[model samples]
Target: MTDHPYNEMPRSDDNQSLFRPVAVGGRGLPGNLALAPMAGATDGVFRAICREQGASLTCTELVSARGIRHDPGWARSWRYLAITPAEQPVAIQLFGADPDDFDYAVRAVLEHPVLSSAFAIDINMVCPVPKVVGTGAGSALMRDLPLAARVIRSAVAAASGYEVPVTVKFRTGWDAATADTPAFARMAEQSGAAMLMVHARTRDMMYAGQADWSVIARVKAAVSVPVFGNGDVRDGPSAVAMLRETGADGAAIGRGALGNPWVFAHAAAALRGEAPLPPPDVAARAQTALREVRERAANLGEARGVRESRKSLLWYLHGTPRAAETRRRAAVVESLKEVERLLADWESSFFDKNGAVHFT
Candidate 1:
């Protein structure tokens, strides 16, 4: 069991084990749980924390091939792909429509000291953010299967020689209005995708509505490569249900992980058919958040760490009382002392809803 610091981690009995090792491109992932590459979230620090909590694999935030080609800041752009020895089995996810750029980017990444730690390469075909779609990247790739194939072939060619597998993550289609993922999945497999992840919703659906697991089922039927089901998976039961419903090799955890890394451990246990563990109580959450703040401060420095803490900090207190005011303070506070003060105030207020504290 991991040194969870708060709760007693559960053990997996052989009979109840829901997970077995999964192989991707000749590399075996310890388990099948993956962390989705959310743009503003899942940076190196957060990725390290989540991996420590149990996510078996993680991909970087989407890097733009065009940016890699023209921007002198390309080195800085690889920040999301930065890895420590502990964050192994990470993938470098890239986005763009230019096949040439895909080739150039992959080769360049294979040589970068910071990014050489990637275990695989993943192309993003599921982003719904208008900027990404308008540029004919992201979900736009879904509309042009031929262009998508070209991009994948280029990336695969560049990496296959090095034995680095390339994967793709995509949504069903533009929306519920059209679902073409089965055909798309077949094309990607033929194009040399080592694995695939289906988000189970259309690009137009964004993160809304229920993720249609039937689409994952369709994609799994369409290809021989491993398929991971994404979207709407919040915890252990949902993770197990995704694999069972679609016959997917595994499930990907996205928004469900905000402020809760333990979901990975719980999901792993739940896969084994164990009881779903209880959520962290207020004090436990407060303490964990405090530790994360220290990690952030040490890794990212006080100013940026404190500045960014507001979002994740608020996420930790998502449903608790006095959350609104704390969110406002967390948004701009600039010191570990300030963060500690806020956590201290919350601990005092955890049982006293009427209690209030003001930031200095």
Candidate 2:
């Protein structure tokens, strides 16, 4: 495998404060490392795995507040909001354009026995997807600050009754030309948001280009509440660099955590001025990938689970020998048995005479 800078140690003094507990309303996270919510990736099973791997906090995929308002029985949104005890200190994220929808959705979540246990109710104003933005939700809210404030207030009012904190996640602005995170941070705080998470990219930038972390520092300066910096924090050194540079209370891992939950452990260790554990070997990666797929199959039916697991399996197999061919085979796997066989074959092919495995 190519050498990665994540394996390097970060300067101790610059990152000493990176691992402290952060308070959000009544909840206190054990550490500042959080697994940022990803819609298609962070399911209940994967959140549990991330938590075990060292994420101090995890969030569910963004659920539609309007959808929840319509499905009082949670028929459509249960899969997205499902949380297990193993993933405690988890947050349930909601997205919607209307204040009334958030009011209704927050109450419904608190009334439900299972979901009520979530550590916080996170409002999504960072998602840049066209479908979400077209509805005046997600990053579109950044363009309408007045409406965003009302939405935050509505959710805060609804959740405060249940003693649950309401947090907001947003981008710098619609684009670099209009970036104004400091102003948005103050408005959210005034609207009763208990904490803030700032993704340093604008909606127009989506996931491309370098993240301007200076925006996070500006937001941190504008708000008294805990703020997490999200964007491009892929490993231990990057996590420390974000904290040191932005003075953010935490670093939230989004795409960085895909198929590499160990990023959390490594970040935590680096924040504590220690060396990170070695990266997982081929055997361990194969086993964990198989376990995730099996658990997904148990929760969702086999067909859907196998279909959904393809991307994650490929992520885990990345950098292994013959990864291109293996990933091509993994993409068309129709059954769990086929997945198991594929992994076994790949693992067997990599082992040398000394029983050591090499990855490219």
lDDT of 1 by residue, 77-147 (tens): 75665667666778989999999999998988887786766889999999999899999999989999999
Candidate 2, residues 1-360, lDDT tens digits: the string is 112221122344544446888888978999989999998998988899989989999999999999999986778998998888999989999999999999999999999999999999999999999999999999999999999999999999999899999999999999888878899999999999988999999999999999999998888877788889999999999998898888788999998899898899989988887977798877888898998899999999999999999989998887776788889999999799999999998787787789776662
Report each candidate's C-alpha RMSD, comma-separated, in the order given. Answer: 6.7, 5.4
TM-score of 2: 0.95
Question: What is the C-alpha local distance difference test score of candidate 1?
Answer: 0.83
Clashes of 2: 0
Candidate 2 lDDT score relative to the true structure: 0.89
Where does model 1 exceed 4 Å of error? Answer: 1-16, 73-76, 351-360
Per-prediction TM-score to the true structure, in the order listed: 0.90, 0.95
Find the 10 residues in a row with the least total lDDT in model 1.
1-10
- Model 2 deviation from native, Cα RMSD in Å: 5.4
